[model samples]
Target chain A: MSDIVTAAMLVIGDEILSGRTKDRNIGHLAEMMTAIGIDLKEVRIVADDEDAIVEALNAIRARYTYVFTTGGIGPTHDDITADAVAKAFGLPCEHDERAYAMLAENYAERGMDFTEARKRMARMPRGAVHIDNPVSIAPGFRIENVHVMAGVPSIFQAMLDNVVPGLKTGTRLISVSIHCPAGEGTIGGPLGEIQKQHPDTIIGSYPKYLDGKFWTELVVRARTPEALAPAEEAVRQMVARLTDSAAAI
Target chain B: MSDIVTAAMLVIGDEILSGRTKDRNIGHLAEMMTAIGIDLKEVRIVADDEDAIVEALNAIRARYTYVFTTGGIGPTHDDITADAVAKAFGLPCEHDERAYAMLAENYAERGMDFTEARKRMARMPRGAVHIDNPVSIAPGFRIENVHVMAGVPSIFQAMLDNVVPGLKTGTRLISVSIHCPAGEGTIGGPLGEIQKQHPDTIIGSYPKYLDGKFWTELVVRARTPEALAPAEEAVRQMVARLTDSAAAI
Candidate 1:
């Protein structure tokens, strides 16, 4: 088995906190991280305050293998992610010539003058590498372990596509989900015993209320299929026994 | 102006971090808090691990006036939130008689046995106040400043509705939104100046990409209409001027 690569996400925007805008980036990033064999351990959403951004960034960056941030990178006064990231690393935030040229040329090609606000998108922490944004011309940047992307869902996704190929990923976690037509209360005790028997697997019981009845979806995940199979079988047996007992009643 | 009441949310569940379940609670809580005159400052989504939950709960609970948590209160081994919250407060977790009676009667009404797993739902920290769960009979609990609720959206909302009437809230913040047909680059500079002039108000510029063109929505928020009006007007004027110039060109 490969070593685990853990990550954390920092979503920076006041619009999200105010509920004016619903966040699409967190789920997308979480799905992408899971698909790419990285464990997304934690996620944080904070307003676009520099102090808040710097504090969250510093706290998570030191703990995780990679840190992904979305939002606060636009051409506005509230867009202070670049400066906050710089402060987190105690490095200088300066305009990157490559990023500036990319935006400058794109705007010029569209017969629009690149204003100073537009130029703000080019700033990055020192020793950063630009992550290309295909949806928009502005580039995201990777400084050390932190990758800062745009808040726009399309742009954030596009930038992540560019960054993924370069990352060192772990082995994909294998998962098997079983639908148990019983509530958590009915299945919890035996499920706990199943979990103990398969110590290498992670078993989670998600309860759902549907059509005036409660049910659960049991998911068994492990670093390898070898570790996952026995757990999956045990869960299925437990579900079958529970359902049989209910049917008898 | 009334004193600000701040809050942070701690979302606990492995399903959320695994991307198997998309969170609806964060946005709902944010909007509700905004409407009820509470400042929702920060949000953290963590897995169902006990140490992770305790660490995050301890960190945010100390900083905010109130901390609201969702998930991991179910009747399963993975449902470790009550234990973690108890540990965070350095209090012993024990079974509460009131909660036990509620669930025992709920199951009895349905002609079902109150199994051991079902009884697990009655556990709570010492000195915790029960938060009524109208949807499901199992009760959520509040210990000091932390309000713990179920992860299900419907149940979480119901539990919060019960808790809100008793909370000390701040003065409601008024918001004015203006849609700008121009991109952030066109309105950012002037918007910054408007924000500086109206230091008492908060101006947020949200960029949206639609129909292959970029536009912006500017929201100005303040504790009163008196502080919100001038900033809102300034943003409107900036958008109007920017659009006129683009049209002329």
Candidate 2:
């Protein structure tokens, strides 16, 4: 409900920790959250161990406005995130009647047996609301501040889209970028001054050595578009002044 | 110097924290370390701030056997990883004569000016060794256990390939996957029993709901090829037994 919404991402699975899978979720979520004006504060990757999941869930959920977790919601023995979430929140995890019914209906339509293993998909923690998975009927759940979704990029992305509109958004985040061929030290001092002048705006510099010259890309971000304009102006002025100084030297 | 080789990754930039870039480096490093048996225990991502970089460097370098950092090593104003690494070790970060010589030669060969901004690429933390960047001349650094590499995938992958073989390796990690059309709970008991039998092996289950049927993918990992074979066999047997139970029910 605050003006600034802060969130943390918990990437679950040994694939991520073991490096077998290069996670595309973190970047996708970060970009989406920023566009919606929610600040992503931290990201932690943990193995699919229940204790680790529970511990991380408790810590992150308590610290941030919202916690988004991906992976381990599957019908496999290693899928323990749902149980962990229930344990972390001290809630009951049982097969939801509605979820089971939906699963049964979905499987029946495909002429598949609603086996016990499939029933695991119907389990939900008490007081949790399901997030529709259009790609797959095994719905993701939202318990308190924690939103548990699938690990697959396509499914995870689909689940996130469904969850975002329901979230309480803060001020819209806006940013501007400028590319300059200059070293950080040459612009570090003046950039600091610009930041001090525009305390509300956050300025970032990314330096790249391309084509044998150092080019620094400066990015300015703010909650309001108005706040971004002055910050951009100050950056331009400082970069020009730094370029001139280097020329004189 | 320790028998147990360890590694950590330092990610620099505010973009990662602000959720603009979902970091791909951590997963890549984790997988690579596992393959070589380096034992990646921890990872940290910090902002482009010098103090934050210094703090992370000191902490990780002291604890881990090897430290690998990606991002913020570029030639831009915000790219401060190089300076911060030098400061953390209490070393002078100055333009290395050899590095400058290399840069000048490389640039001249490419018909580009060795401008003052480009000179930033030559700065190295005192006593640091260079990690070759086949993609560009802005070499990454290696000091003690720390191996700095570029953030770009193509370049980072190349640098890693160059650096990995040099480090002392443990047993290689191998994995096997088996799919079962059953829920995790049906196999959880047997899965736990198998894990207990093979303490050295890590068994994981990932559940998927596709076409309205629950199917779980179980993966078993071990340090040695021989160990992986037995562990994977045990998982396959357990899954088969669970499948039988589901079919009967």
Candidate 3:
């Protein structure tokens, strides 16, 4: 396994494209991946089209260590993600006997009829391992490096919580942040020098305007607390330098 | 003048890719475009890499009616959206005289020194027009169909509010939603029939698991309120039929 694990998120839904629903999965996944030391490299939102999903899955899965997809795994006409994933991997998709049994039991527990539409949830790509859905009995699945998940924030989150613990992890992430009312260019050179000095730390600067004055919030993250302290100190010194430079100008 | 007014979003930042930031701009732009009758066909989140931004800009600008980009318009070293935009359009990027004047006045009002880094905020691609920034003096710009705005939610939102009023709107969006405790497959056929019957309305189904039970929320959207009613009724009838069928099962 590579020292640095990377992942990409694919959000599939026409509802998202039409703006009928706001997507909450990206934020949830980003935070989760960060906690587990997996670097999330890119995110793409596409319609519920099979061609789009297949294209995105093929592109991202080949590039990243893991590819997580959300939405379009439901018992609906538009729920084509399973088919797309199967097509992407060139795998066979059929109703898994195990998944169907679990769905039947779940439906019986709720005193609901397991209609043919509901049965659609049991269809899984051949050779895929089922992901436990604690909130809903309809299991998500993992085939090759791709993890298929539901789009609902709460359920998706729960499913991710279940799935992440099983994956290999690197060092835990640690971070520190500082704020200054100076533009980035004022600190750019110094910041670049500090980054050069601390190659292990990731330094990010976000600029914002508060009370009609420009300000920036700088954050430094590292794999260890030891590596983070020097980065934080370097950032603090750079911010101070920038502040002084601003005052002098 | 095109019958189909299309738009694409350019999200610029490494923070988003690094999992340091979860973007909310795409959903915001998607909703805004739908409401104003502009079709938001594609969205791409590129890192703050100049070459990548230029490549994405060249690809999307030629295909869409409008391109709105969010992020990287900050006063940071990595915030190179303006430079990349200028490069993409093959135009010289220089400090806009009007924007520089406005920013100078803004800094003077707060008794702050307008450093050279702060002057970077005034830079725009040649022949670009400034979009008013009610929140800050870092004005966004519109060069042809491409509108570049800030990435921060509050600032992006304010910039959009100001920019939207000046654009031409073709239709007002109206929507109707109904919740049914039935799976989508049960309703998929009926939903398809309804869509066939009313070709004007867009009917979508979102399946969710709430309180440990499966349910689908069906929505109908159209240009007119009257069209919404018929679509809504059709969905209702479809749901009723599905429920009846499930009961028989």
Candidate 4:
């Protein structure tokens, strides 16, 4: 936990809050962050209002090593993310000329009119770095440690792929999951004891009620394989004991 | 906005943050809250750590009219929501006889022993109101305005159904979506002007790239039909103009 590189996400969209659109970025980001060394500590989903965006940005940016915000960076009236980011950082927002050219070229190639609303996508806070948009020409921006991204899942994933490989992350946490046919109540005490014994490993118990049978899973996570091995063995042995007794019953 | 009943959600689970499980509660709760006239303003997903849970609870409870927390209330080691809620409220967490009796009866009917881990589900904050769980025997609790429910989708939905009908709510916000075959850039300017004109209605522009074609949607929302009707008409006219222009091209 001491050396774990922590990150947080801010998901901004009215559609998500209204249940009109289910979020896809959170799950994809979580999986990718876990595969790398970053510990995704928290996620906050807020509406498109500027105050809500600023408050969430300030809170998440201050707490974690990195903050990735998705949504409201589009060519529309409600796309207030860039303006909110500028307000949060006390900086002026302006159109980045380079991003403008890139977007203009993209539109030209597609035989579409590059209107003023499309130009709005180029705006970002002062001292911001452009994050590439592989799927679209409208680039996401990075101010300090906060990475702004598109709300659309494909564009968000592309921006994340462009950003994550370059970040400073810690040791990738190794995870091992044990699928146990035993119930949580039958195995909870021993699992807790095992978790306490291995303080470095994070042990989680997940219960599933499937086919009218209650089964539980024990997952162990550690910074290194060496740390994960012992805790995993403990869980396997405990599950074996419980499974044998339950079979006898 | 004056009478809007605002709500926030805290999803407490390591499994969601770790990407082992994709959260299904937020969308379900959001849709249900919208149906009953509550604006789900903010959502926070935190790990099973007590400090994180307590911090999210304190912040959201002070700001929102209601807080609904899902997960971390099971019969497992990581099921620490009850204790965390108790710590946040400065209350004693004790076994409720009513909950214990209900769970005991349910387990007896299934011919299973009510073990210690099972009993942990009965522990709730002092002076908490028990929210019935139709799927499982363990009851969720409501302390003040923060409703603590199970992470499982079915149980969470059942608890929400039992709890939401009793709460005082405002006028349900009505929404209308206009699917425009045109792009966001074509409609952004006029939409912003219309939004400025009709300050009561919230218009959101969502762009989509579907089936290799570019399309956008304008969603209009207002608390009353009287407020929404004119704004919806304006969007329809705007989209009609955009479609004509694109056709001419």
Strongest candidate by lDDT? 1
DockQ of each: 0.74, 0.31, 0.45, 0.67
Candidate 4 C-alpha lDDT tens digits along A57-83: 998899899999999999889999999
For residues B1-249, could you state the per-residue lDDT of candidate 2 as single tens digits? 345576767777778876655566787789789878877765666667898789868977997778888877665556677898899989999998888898899868866567665677788898999888877767888988888887766678888888997898865667787887765545665676788889888887765556645566778887678788888888887767766764521
Can you tell me which runs of candidate 3 are displaced by over 4 Å?
A170-173, A181-200, A209-214, A223-227, A240-249, B17-22, B90-92, B168-173, B181-189, B196-200, B223-229, B240-249
Sort the candidates on DockQ, descending order: 1, 4, 3, 2
Kindly report which residue pairs in candidate 4 clash with one another: none
Pick the winner on DockQ between candidates 2 and 3. Answer: 3
> Relative to the true structure, how large is the alpha-carbon lDDT of every model?
0.91, 0.78, 0.81, 0.90
What lDDT tens digits, residue by residue, belong to model 4 across residues B67-125? 99999998888899999999999999999899989989987887777888889999999
Q: Which has the better lDDT: candidate 1, or candidate 4?
A: 1
Consecutive 10-residue window with the lowest summed lDDT within model 1 chain A: A240-249
Clashing pairs in 3: none
lDDT of 3 by residue, A1-249 (tens): 457788888989878867778888877787788778887767777888888788878988998889899998887666888988999999888999999999898778867778776788889899999998887778999998899999988879889988998887766668887986675645655666787799888777887656655577788888888899988997887767766774622
lDDT, candidate 2, equals 0.78
Ranking by TM-score: 1, 4, 3, 2
Error of 3 at A143 (Å): 2.2
Q: Candidate 2: give the clashing pairs.
A: A19-B31, A27-B22, A75-B207, A117-B183, A184-B77, A207-B75, A207-B76
